[model samples]
Target: MFILSGLFCIPTDWHVLIITFMNAKVESWCARPEQLSDMPVSTWKQLSGQVNQTCQIKNIDWDAVTNETDISGEFGMKDCTKWEYDDSQFQSTIIGDFDLVCGRDVLIDFAQTIYFVGMIFGVLTFGILADILGRKSVLIILLLFACLTGTITSQMPNFTMFAISRVVNAFFIIGIFETHFTYCIELVGGKWSTIIGMGMEYFWVIGWLILALLGYLIRSWRSLTLLISLPSLSAVFMIWLLPESPRWLIAKGKLDQAEKILREAAIMNGKPLPDEWKLKPVKDFENTKKTTIFDLFRTRNMRGKILILYYNFFVTAFLYYGLIFNIGDLGGDVFVNFAASGFLEFPAYGAAIFVLMKCGRRIPYGTSLILSGLFLLSVSFVPRGVYYKDWPCMVLALIGKTCVTFAFGALFVYAAELVPTEIRTSAIGSASFLGRIGGTIAPWVGKLSIYHPYLPVTIFGVNALIAGLVSFLLPETQGQELPYTIEESEKLELASLIAPSILKPAKSTQPMEQEMIEFNNIPEKVEENEEDNLSCYSGDSALSQKVCS
Candidate 1:
């Protein structure tokens, strides 16, 4: 009350002083709301220099004098009868323009969370459809539908309508992300998988850079959303360029189709097929046994491994996205902070490549997770509401962000290697399903900041720590052959856990290539039996047993 009194009651001497200051400035032009649009060319040219000083206010007390008489009386304040907004700012966001202030703020978080709900739905269905229908077709369809829905979202009339449109947009967007990663990796041959995967990953970084630039230039959320999704239209046309996944075709028992795609791929690369390469018709297709989610839990050790990996995936994704969407709470230029944090991802990916190659997967994976956890924990301790608070908080946050990104990159490859080939896709699909669950819950976790500023960051810290601890239990697959079957994977559990160093796969062995060729050459029952007999006579009983098994 005293503060309000001091504010409302200005001394007579100060009033005279303020009038004198106003008299000095009264000779110059002041840009009023009514006068802004009609200003002359010369006035418009000089307005930028004078506007910031006179137009914008650092503090506003909206309730001080709400009535029209009070606005026009001694203070001469602008009347805001229906709507209120500061006209001096360069851009207007959804929250600012729609008045999504204190009472309605949860709508923002809920809107974001609803998008993730769509993503969770997408994650469950897209991978299965991709495996069944074909990667190219699914990707094209997603691109078309996502582009359509995203454009609709931009034109929505209300927050509710906008949030609903985001759900549809998110469904197709997740499909775009998942299907494209799979399609691009399949298009590249085995020797170039790492290079192609890294290249594809760079597209996401470019996306971040583009988003930052667009947000700065296009302040309207509707315009920005449209611009961000416009690239999907281009993707729709890429149907002509993208080929179906040969590996997927082969798994679906379409050997002839797979062969045709691979032959075309070989021709495109200017690499002649091996003189011995032949498209033998596959009779006994191995893909007859359709793996289900239950397959992941059929065995005890496998179940434990899958559960642990899924937990790690969930925690890693939860913390990673929780930090990303909560950037507004850190108190700075949100664009600059988001861009700065996103820019670190490039170096993070590069570092991931280096560390994975030199040190191995587990070291980089576990260490990155632990370091990220520690950094986030440190962020919780930084003194808030003081000078230089943002600097320390931002630094720690960005560092944590980079580490989590690096760990995420490693986790993708590590998870693929941990599971056997027969159910590799299913295992990864399950892990991703869990990850999406975590992502869906992340925005709600971010809202906990309203209760306590430290709560969100502390949750991130705890998740990262838990993920880091669980990652150690995963076996290292560095320099080891990926297991092809359940029995083979079972044989490696003891060795993988006990002495991974003792079992180095021979470089001379081309088991993956051999496996591919062997699957392609599936023969008649009689011929297969004869081949088994020949293999027995040739003293390669283990190979025969493996093939027969």
Candidate 2:
């Protein structure tokens, strides 16, 4: 069952990297800029190659445009509208097939931006729906439509059709991925939360590496599109193997359904339930006031957590996606650059796992953000006089990428742990919605590079710096039980920023060590009532035991 949900992360993560590669394809049909110069006739043939063979000849007075823009010594600048593209570079793409070059370049960004716009809708629609509808059912429905719209997007005749279909595809696919994340976390006991969450992120790293390989092998945009979308076919079969989240069912008052799933799980694990054993909703969790989105902001503690976490989500998406979209422009073999960037994430996630367990979530999560921001800012200062300027710049970028990847992997579990169980999906959904706003803005950052190369990284660095500083204010959740209700969440103590953790208790921090000792000294008791029994079977207790072990 642990492996089953891990398998689900592959396709969802692939969708994120796939669209990044898709931008490479769709934007492939850029206008082949022409150099209008007064070079000798014989020099023209020498300078022109396969890329510029199809260039349109335009007669313009060289003196008239001399001060208007910088004209190259080899090729003077000419209007893109009058230029023709080299077909050898791009055989087919939405940009190529529809001749969407020059003035229409924004469409490429539009196509990419709209997907995140759709993701905003997906997060909103599915976040609440996952809570209302069973996570498994809503996920399946989303998967079905994701496959359909993805296929339709591949076959679109024009940019409008492709953009529209992609928007719809993104809406459902992003929803499925986010909902499945919530489902996977809920499916596990809390003890395995970091492992399960980070393990799934490792799959996302694998998906990016796979996309790089596929993008290399499949040159045509449409072919690559279809190849990536093909996995959605397996989503149907995967659906049959998945189970409704018992936690969600319990939350929604579906005890019979929840019990059936739990019993089957127990049977599969060879730990048969007692003959008298019966599962029911926890009494304290029942008849809780109906939660609304406003509930997140209604309380003082929650409002701060919600706002800070929301910004963290935004910063995470901003830095992560911004770095991804800029990879192609980094001056290397696009394929190698993409693959190398993806490769660094493997160790990043591994490091994240280590730090999250040993150092606790708040310090590691915040430190990673700070380090990534510092690295990103430092890239602009790489000495131009160096023999290999590009290498230093790329290394700095990769380091920043690695740090953000580590932060993002841990951020999901951190966010999940901070929010209460009942409204967990909605909280995640809202955070994701804010994250997509940053995602939507990422493509525009690439555009900012034209004004100044460092401008985009500067914006990313600033956001990351703010987010990292704010992370210190968040309560740490490592070695703590997940709260099941708003009241329980409210009772959770805010770990002092300067206080030493149990894992690294300072000499002055006797209170933290004493608290840990007291918590451990508490003896476990057998279930004597329905509520006690429910807590044992609810997965949280099992998770805590796993953590202790």
Candidate 3:
């Protein structure tokens, strides 16, 4: 399973890079001024290539116009970064000076807008079906549609048709990316869940990295999309080899099939099945209860669920997407910027791995988001010459990129952990659906700030701020067990809410080494996550065991 997800890295980065690549060119073109009417014939000759090219807008003074406004926020900086796009209205969506870029941007603009629409709607529809059907069935459906639609979308005949296809492809395909955490949780025992499930998304950066490289080579979003599109078919075939979710099977009373999947896992792990692994008669999860929308809203604890989802949806999409689309605005080598930006992501995944085990969720998740926001704000204030200079801007941009990557990695587990298993997938699916709203709006955010680089910083900063505060509203899921149901998972501090505080929570400043030694001793991946959680449970026992007699 990890291997398949690792493979997904190629296309995932490809998706971001290609999209970013497209967005960069249109933005850079818009930032420049109109060229002189009586320019040299040699310059006119330069106009020859620009005239008909789908991307280039002919006869523009790209240089003078950039002075009128700073697109990268740091008015004077230029550097390496990642984040990228084209379609006419779509072009306008991200950059308002649409006229300057020629009409080619209209098609690019529409394509991205339509694609996001497809993404938003596709997640909801697929999630409902996922809850009704087993996870495995929906897996096949999403993969098939993803494979066929993604491949077909690549061959779109015209701009209008292609834009519509982006929506369709996004709708059918995005459900899988959104559902991965839930599906992984169901597949593994509690112990191995966080690293394996969330770790898969780190490799997603690898997909963006690939596209960054490809942007240097292929230079077209269409070709880049086409290149990765081939993998969906293979993904369908590869996933067919995977086992179904046993928990889902048991929920539907398909105990026999559930056991079969479990046996496969046991064999894969080379471990003997527990005695309780034997298949038995089962009953449906919905046997005695009503499952409805109100169920998600009725509980006080569920409100936390809503808060986390909305925060994640908006923050992840807004900061991550907005910045990527705006990367080219910094006025540097597009390929270098994209690659350097992507390279920042490698450390983020490693940081997440350490933080998830040692630091717990709240600090890592909350602080990273706040830091990302702070950096964006910092970029706005950095003196143009000192901060906006090539290396300086690159350094800041990379720092900003790293923070978002960390937040995203943490959210995979944090979001999934917020809800109970029954509605967990649906919750994640819904939040992610709305999260793509940030993605939908990001291009517009970029476009609106065409002349002002600091505009996106303000916009993304607010998003980061909202996400960080809302994160505080959520329970600390780090030391907590994965909730079996929404009820079991959250012990709403109602009593403490109203009652006088008994004791203030103590801060731990114990050296990091003690924790590292305990962490390093774990023999298996499952043992690490499980031990961290179980060790929390065995607080007294663990302390006693370590005590000197």
Candidate 4:
């Protein structure tokens, strides 16, 4: 069921790339007046005297021009009142449909920024709601609303309505992403957590690949959007098929509900529930204070961790989306380049999982960021006019994409591991909110190429380097257990500082039992009656054992 829920990533991830095609630039020029309708296009261009211009045409008196042989002299240029577009590349797009050319071209970027702004709100709003309302209910709601908004987006008659629908669609899309991510993470533990967390990114890459194909085949933006959105309607039925997170149920003091879910899971796995097992709510579940984003900053150690996480998230989204949006400027077939970008992520994610499991999270993640920065920075120095220059630039950019993809996958698992379960979604949402801010600015920064082609890449590269350096300050969570509370998280930080080399699994050994018992405040006498002690403790025995260890 958890794996099936990952299908939501299709529309969510496809929306991110569809913007590239939706606002694609097409060949356009000032429309000839009705009086010159009989003239050849070549003759019309000669008269206009602004033949090369897309947004302006020379002020020409069509009534005075009687002969096609009459060549035009230089005339004052004027803003084009009407435009004609060539449909060779794109049959229709927001750019051509809305005449977002010349002075109004920036609206394309503005619309994308608005979409990301909505994503920021979605992450925060849905993250909190998932914790309070339960992940299952929130996900079902988001899926239904996302489908509705996405369908409405296709029927918008004007740019204003289109933008409004897109922003609202973006809101629900991110909500589904965050709620689903939190629920999936809560379902498993230990090595499975790493596998599930990083592995889920593959679905995102698949969506990207499929979007490239769809963009190539469907040249009309409205039709393409409707096609991609229809699949989500099927996912709305997940309310009946999906189960609530047992972990979240336990946290909310719904012991019976959690037990029922766990028992079913055990049965599905062909492993019967142990006769001695019991459902126990976390200690103080009723009295526990609700955690919010502010709680992440309450402790000195957590504050430092979250600050570094924010910067890393910002740089990741900035560089990732910046590179994607800039693909049109890479001097090649945009569809082919887009496909290559998505294809490279497969190996990148594979490499990420391998390294994350073997080498831990901090070093590999930080190094990937630094390496990607170097690749991006190198693209500027590859001589521009050389016959092979475009190839080198494309190669470097694709390599950077791979590196950044690796870093992105690793960061998701790492961030989830660092934050405690109680405030996990909120903390992830807060960090992701910073990422959306960076994503919002990426389009405008891509526009900086008008002044200097390398300016945006240089900025992305430098920010990545700085973020990579800061990432090392975060403690390694490679073999460590997921922290359930602020105090537990702080202990992991202190342990990393003190014993830096000892990387052990969370399972308790005889020698570590005393430390775990003291940390969890369990009486020594409880060790004599392990079965009774498990029943009295909060959360699952695995979690209690982790705490004890």
Candidate 5:
């Protein structure tokens, strides 16, 4: 409980704080005309004289200019004349407008994206470690490292140091996230999977609220970071409240320990286990064979499927993070912008609850992405001065934001549903890795837009369009029970979906075609071969012979 709550408050702040601080700096730089390029020395002398003349008019001594190098202990002015009476050099920083900095934000944006890239690698590597050692073991290692390294990042003396620390911290925290997702979901039953999965997202909102309150109080970016680290101090105690997942224990062949944990859960829920609830050694462990990373591409459909996943995930991350990081540049007070954004998300969340509960997953998931792309493109050309209303641009930006937000929520659930249990996390994590690169590219995309105003939005719109079309490449998982293995997943016309999408079978769906999509209408069933091949996790392929300890 504490670890989740504590670590939970960290990243949401990371995302919003940088944009807020940088935006302010960018505007301050632009307000002074000194940084403007191409102003001749004669123009400079004129502006300087004009300023000095103002001092004369006011009959007050103009404040004596201080040397910037004297204050910062760097950058000697070898060509002293360069600083002389030059109005263009008068601005204190690089780039004038916050929007221009938004245009130039390649450096900081890459840092942010690379941080998430580290997370994808972390999931893959630590997932293996979690299986080899215990989940609790890996969690402890990652959390301690995360708390230590993550706080140190705030105190980094330079951008390079900060970037390196951020990646290190990203690696650790993501390991914790991957472990926690599987652990918490297992402790409850499979029936509660959606609740456990979706419920955790509320922590993200909690982090945002804390950030808003902290932003109100601290304001300074570094101090806000210090506040984020405060939560980590309480994590050690909070994690002790819940027991390890009973299912994880059973997978390790620890029937006694699994039973103990299950009994404790029953006691907590105030219910008794039925006779069939008793733990027994699973015979499904028979014939468990070794699987490798290469196995993912060995089969014809599998190779093509991986390619499509790579495509889907890459585009998903690119569009999602790009839009999020650049939200302020659409033009507004960032605090108000961030707040309105948070408020707008309520409708998205409400829609998720409604759709997942009543209508099921397929349409809402696909529609969210399709509409997201369309709305974004609609905003792309929203002229600064419309035919009638000048406010049309801002209105379009807000609408684009809402559409993307809803799709962001949809993608998380949608990805979890696509693959059979055999390789779900690996597929998702591998895709996320590519996506993180897209995320890394996002800030640069935003920066590119500073030079080319419509660049980032158009790029984002294109990706959303592709991802929306590719949604059909994935089979609709609505009524089917979560397939526990490749055999089960294949038994459904998995080939049918894959065939349409391949570079061969991936199902690259056009919007109209998605509505016409249908299942093979086979018996609502799990194949016998699939049930017999239960060597992997209930939802992802985390094991070959047995669930790792």
Candidate 6:
């Protein structure tokens, strides 16, 4: 089920990311008026004195100059109402098809911005629904509609319909990702959660690579959209293949269903459930208070953590998507650059997994963000003469992209571990909700290049630096079990505060080593209890053991 859930990443990621190509700015110039119809394009430019201008044409009467040559003089320029595009690279893009250039250029960014706005609502709404309706149902519903809406997006006859369909598609795309993330995490709750969570990004990278290939091959925005959208219909088969999250079922007091699923899993693994062990409701669930988004903010410690996570998530999305959307401006083949960017993420994710295990969550997460910022800042400083440009800036951007990708993959695991299971989906939803706000702003920020070439990177770099610093304020959840309730999550925050002192050496290194050994045995002691033993099936004990190993 976990592996199958990961497969959905390909289509979901493509749907969300294809916008980078769809709205790409193609080379364009002001169209010649009817009077200049007989003139060659180069002659028209020279005759009208409109060289190097995209949005303006010289306001000169050509009737008097019809028979004249060399009638050159300065003239006032007028904003171009119609444009022609160079279609050598892309046969058609939204920018060309809709004439989204110059004054209308911001609308290109606006389309992506509104898509992310829909993502904000998608995560929040579907997150709560996943928590209530069960993960399987939510995943199936999202997949079906996401595919449908994405296909409709390609058929939209006008910009208004295109934007509307994209918004709806974004809604389902984000929901599919969030719901699947929550489902996969819950399905494999033990030490494997980190691997499962971060590993999901590998599938995303696969989709990204394919997107680059598709974009290069198709060259038309509409066809590319149709190609990416149609394949997602295959994911609808998950209805039968996917199971309801056992952890969620138990939380909702449906023990029979939860037990049946657990038993099936145990049998498949050839580790039969112990007759003595039985399914039990989590003690936190019996209170009947109903988990809401407020539960995340109900306590002081969790509130601080959630807020910091929100900012980190915002920074992650801001820099990550900003860099991706600006691939065309990076001075290379857009397809190659996009593919290279995706390829570099493999190593980044590998490094993220290694550091997450060795350094724990907080240090590596914060450090990656800082490093990503530094690299982005360096991109602006690279000498910009013809001899020292392009490749250097591209190299720096790629490095920054790698670091941010590390942070991006790590943040998912870190955020999932921080929130308790009862409201886990909702909490992640809310964090992503805030993150989408940053994503919404990223396209507009990408447009800042018109003012200054380095302005966008500079802004992204500075924000990443601040966010990196803010990440240290968050508690680390590297070796700890996934919190099952609000109180457990709060206790994690409190424990993180005193953990250093608690493990402080009294005198010799030998004693500290011994203390570490004893500390590692704590879960073993907890496992002796029947109530606590049930956690093994749910993945907590297995996760703790894996972390320690």
- The global Cα lDDT (0 to 1) of model 3 is 0.58
TM-score winner between candidates 1 and 4: 4
C-alpha local distance difference test of each model: 0.57, 0.69, 0.58, 0.76, 0.52, 0.76
Worst ten in a row by lDDT for model 5: 511-520
As a TM-score, model 2 comes out at 0.82
Clashes of each: 0, 4, 38, 1, 17, 2
Residue 70: error of model 1 in Å?
5.8
> Which of 3 and 6 is ahead in TM-score?
6
Candidate 1 TM-score versus the reference: 0.73
In model 4, what is the error at residue 109, expressed in angstroms? 1.9
lDDT of 4: 0.76
Summarize candidate 1's per-residue lDDT along 85-191 as a digit string, tens digits. 33333244555444554355556567666776777777657776776687778767877676688679778777778778878877766666666655554443222
Off by over 4 Å in 2: 25-56, 59-90, 284-287, 327-332, 493-549
Question: After superposing candidate 6, which stretches have Cα over 4 Å from the reference?
Answer: 29-40, 43-50, 54-81, 274-277, 284-287, 326-328, 378-387, 390-394, 446-458, 494-549
- Model 1, C-alpha of 393: deviation from truth (Å): 3.5
Better of 2 and 3 by TM-score: 2
lDDT of 6 by residue, 1-549 (tens): 666677765788888778778977678878866666767778777666667777787776545556454666777887877888888888889998888888887788788789998898898999999888988898888888877998898888888989999889988889888888888777654346677778888888888898888888899999888888887788767767777887677667787887677667656655555555565566645556887779888878888888988888888998888887774465567788678777888999888777776667777888899998999999788767665447778877878888899998999898988887778888899899988998888867877889998999999999989998877767766656666667767875633433463232112111111111112222222244454444332222532332221
Collision pairs in model 2: 35-75, 35-76, 36-76, 191-543
Q: Write the per-residue lDDT of candidate 5 for residues 1-549, one digit (tens) a residue.
A: 324533543553444334444234421221113443455544433434433321111112223322221222222221111222212212221112112232334554555567777776777777666644555656666666766775786677656776787788788776766666555444332223444455655565555655665555555555555556556555466457555545445545567876666556545555443333344544355676533345557676656656766776677667767777765454556566555555666776666755654554545655667777777777666775555554565566556666666655656555555544444445555666676677767767877776777777788887778876766555554434443455544543433433533222222221111100011111122222254432221222122112221
RMSD of 5: 10.1
Clash list (residue pairs), candidate 4: 516-548
The candidate scoring highest on TM-score is 4
Per-residue C-alpha lDDT of model 2 across residues 1-549, encoded as one tens digit per residue? 556655654665655566555555432321323343444333443333214533332333433543245434454434434333344534555656666655666787788889898898889888888877778888878877776777787788888888888888888877877787788777654336677778777667677888888877777778878777767667677666877877777666676877677667666655655555565454344446776667877778888888888999999998998888774465557788778777788898888877776777888899899999999899788765574556877778878988999999899999887887677888889899999999898978877888988888888888889899888878777665555566656654455556655235122111111111112222234344453443332222432232121
Per-residue CA lDDT of candidate 4, range 1-549, in tens? Answer: 656788755676877678878987787777777767776667666567655666767666655666553544656777888877779889999988888988888798888899998898888888888877888898888877777887899899988999999899988888877777778877766555677788888888889899999999999999998888888777667777888876677666776887677657656655445555565556466677876678888888878889889999989988888877774465578788778777878999999888887777878888999999999999899877684557888788878978888998888898998987777777888888888888888878977889998898899889888898788777777656666666667775622433444343332222221211112222223332354544333333355453221
